[model samples]
Target: MHAPSQNREFLGVGWRFPLQVTPNGRIAQARHEQRIEEAIVIILSTAPGERPMLPEFGCGIHNTLFAPNDSRTIALVVHQVRQALTRYEARIDVLDVHAENNLDAPNLLLIRINYRVRETNAIGNLVYPFYIREGR
Candidate 1:
């Protein structure tokens, strides 16, 4: 995978999402990110001193069609998440999302997506850890 976008900052992050999937494209990732974004928006919109937390979000993987050796689905998910995060003026870092087992449902997968406000400073030696979870 490519280096995590430099615009986003990582301050130690992790996440958990329900392991559930249907025939349609996986919704856990999308739903998880959406909820996180909503939560951040709600918090940031509050009155001064009312904001409960800084921008942050996470999720877990459920029934997936990818394996540890398969990078296609994983890559697509990363790209999708990256694009989605951009809408929130944020980015995902240290993302680790996948199923623990390769042959079944109800897998306990965890995703640690670090969220941060986008930065304009594009000049610097920056390195972000973009971790990807897989079947193991």
Candidate 2:
């Protein structure tokens, strides 16, 4: 099951991952810090796989320095997160960002971004593995 939408609103400081959003006013985020940590331990325990999806970044995992609001950062974090979901090989949606400022405190800036994931049908006959299996 996917993460709950309400968790997304919280300020994700630690090892939280923002997922999708529901039809209502809820947001989705994941708290897989422990699981990811364990995965890292296992990955490091081995001599590394031939074709590892994630590369080592000192501690043992890849892309661990990504932040929501960083200089020279624009949709890169969301893109990386979406790319990792290719296991389902679904089509990823564009990230939408909206910056809003309070009228009382006009200087205070607040950014609200939404990154949605969608699944689309694959093209070509490769979708069907069976060739000619008929018993009629």
Candidate 3:
């Protein structure tokens, strides 16, 4: 059997999203599952056309920014999340995507995604807070 670290090699290693520099003056990196999670975040957080070279990249959820807080809008957000992850993150298989309104914050929507790592069959989930309305 391969070592724990070696077994996770298929998940890949990459620079952390938002780009950080370590105290040692080296670029920060994410490995294995952490790298996959961060990739999902980057895919979902970015809007289409936001990247100059990759205009088609990113989730479509940004289009719902002005959409009303209702079942229809929630469904759209779920769809966007699923579509983006399926298209951008090749390391995992998307199992489900759902969204709920934050009780204390009317403008906030909590998006939950359940996924399984394709190579290792490891299951994971992430809850991303999306703001449909800009804070005043």
Q: Which TM-score value belongs to model 3?
A: 0.90
Q: Give the CA lDDT, 0 to 100, for residue 44 in model 3.
A: 90
What lDDT is reached at residue 112 by model 1? 28
Give a tens-digit lDDT track for model 3, residues 107-132. 88999999998887889999999998
User: By lDDT, who's the top model here?
Assistant: 3
Candidate 2 lDDT, 1-136, residue by residue in tens: 6555434323223432324565785664343332232332333233223346644211211332332233233244334323333322223233443333345553332433333433221121111011111122
Model 1: how far is 56 from its true place, Å? 22
RMSD of each: 16.2, 20.1, 2.4
Local accuracy of candidate 1 as per-residue lDDT tens digits, 16-104: 23344646945433333343445433322233333246323221111232335245545554454444334433432323322122333
What TM-score against the true fold does each predicted structure earn? 0.27, 0.23, 0.90
Give the winner by lDDT: 1 or 2.
1
What's the residue-level lDDT of 60 in candidate 3? 97
Instruction: Tell me model 2's lDDT, rounded to 2 decimals.
Output: 0.31
User: How far does residue 60 in candidate 3 sit from its true spot (Å)?
Assistant: 0.5
